[model samples]
Target: MYMLRKFRKVFSLIILTTMMSLGITAPGYAAMLGTDDILAGDNLQQQRDYVKELLNRDEVQNQLADMGVDPLEAEQRVDAMTEQEIQTLSSQLEELPAGASALGLLAFVLVVLLITDLLNLTNVYNI
Candidate 1:
């Protein structure tokens, strides 16, 4: 009985020592995430969805076609973009004007032509 008790004590001591050594060698880490850190992942997904939706639009698709860009390839490229690039693109999209009138575009073109004519870059106008 005494021998059994001694063997049990030695076994317990070995287990305790092994556990302590493992605890020292392999420590676990935990940290509290901030709201931004948690939401950033969701925001990236939302941005990707927004870009894909834009790519799916008929007008956008037609524009891409006219520009010789394949809509599917553009979408794949968007998918391949890094988080920072996606965020920057999303922010730029937000900053774009919601709509522009044909008259506004015509005026902008006329202004550009006038500027070029004044600089003698082109004799588009006999001014």
Candidate 2:
């Protein structure tokens, strides 16, 4: 019984030493989120969803196809956009006139995609 206790103590000591030496510990960080920060995250997601929904529309998809831009590839490009880019696009979308034609919206999207392609941020378009 004494030998068993000694072995357990020694084994535990070895394990603790090994763990400490190897630095096998997970680091954590915590911060209190402000209302604006939390709301901004939600708003960003909503903006992304709104853009995706617009892209998924049959008219938009058809326009993209006609322009030789794959709708799926365009969606992927939007996903890769930075927060600033999304915010800019979303703001522009909000600024559109209430009577704006679908063609105007489609043209705006195509222009954005073309700029991204030129910047080499996306490979959706051959040009």
Candidate 3:
């Protein structure tokens, strides 16, 4: 225990001496990240990957197929888009409200209608 305590004191002393010798001092004020700095720190590839992930969603793939676009071809097109396009798409996707799409609403309505018809709570479909 004595030896451990001595070692700790020596270590602390060494650290203090080193700090004094190097003139190390804490900053007077905390560093602040500006919006431009934060945005600039993000790389193009990250934006591309985000856009790719969004495109790979099942709903997105189904929609692409419905629009007569092959999912693989859409992926290739995403890769072909410029960095700016990827950024734009990623930003737009980020801004969208979840489950607020027209397709999503249509599916929700269809499910509700089917459920009501099955329970005989509604005669809307006469099923």
TM-score, every prediction: 0.53, 0.76, 0.46
Looking at candidate 2, the ten consecutive residues that score lowest on lDDT are 96-105
| Candidate 2 local lDDT, 6-77, one digit each (tens) | 999999999999989898767899999999999999999999988888778888789888988888888887
Candidate 3, 45-125: lDDT as tens digits: 787777667667788678766755566755665576566666766666666677754354234334544565587754445
Residue 37 Cα positional deviation in candidate 1, in Å, after optimal superposition: 0.8
Please give the RMSD to the true structure for each candidate, in Å. 13.4, 4.2, 17.1
User: Which ranges of candidate 1 are over 4 A from the true structure?
Assistant: 1-28, 100-127
Residue pairs clashing in model 3 are: none
Question: Relative to the true structure, how large is the alpha-carbon lDDT of every model?
Answer: 0.67, 0.84, 0.64
Pitting candidate 1 against candidate 3, the one with the higher lDDT is 1
Output the better candidate (1/2) by TM-score.
2
Model 2 Cα displacement at 55 (Å)? Answer: 1.1
Error of 3 at 114 (Å): 35
- Segments in model 3 whose C-alpha atoms lie over 4 Å from true places: 1-42, 101-127
TM-score, prediction 1? 0.53
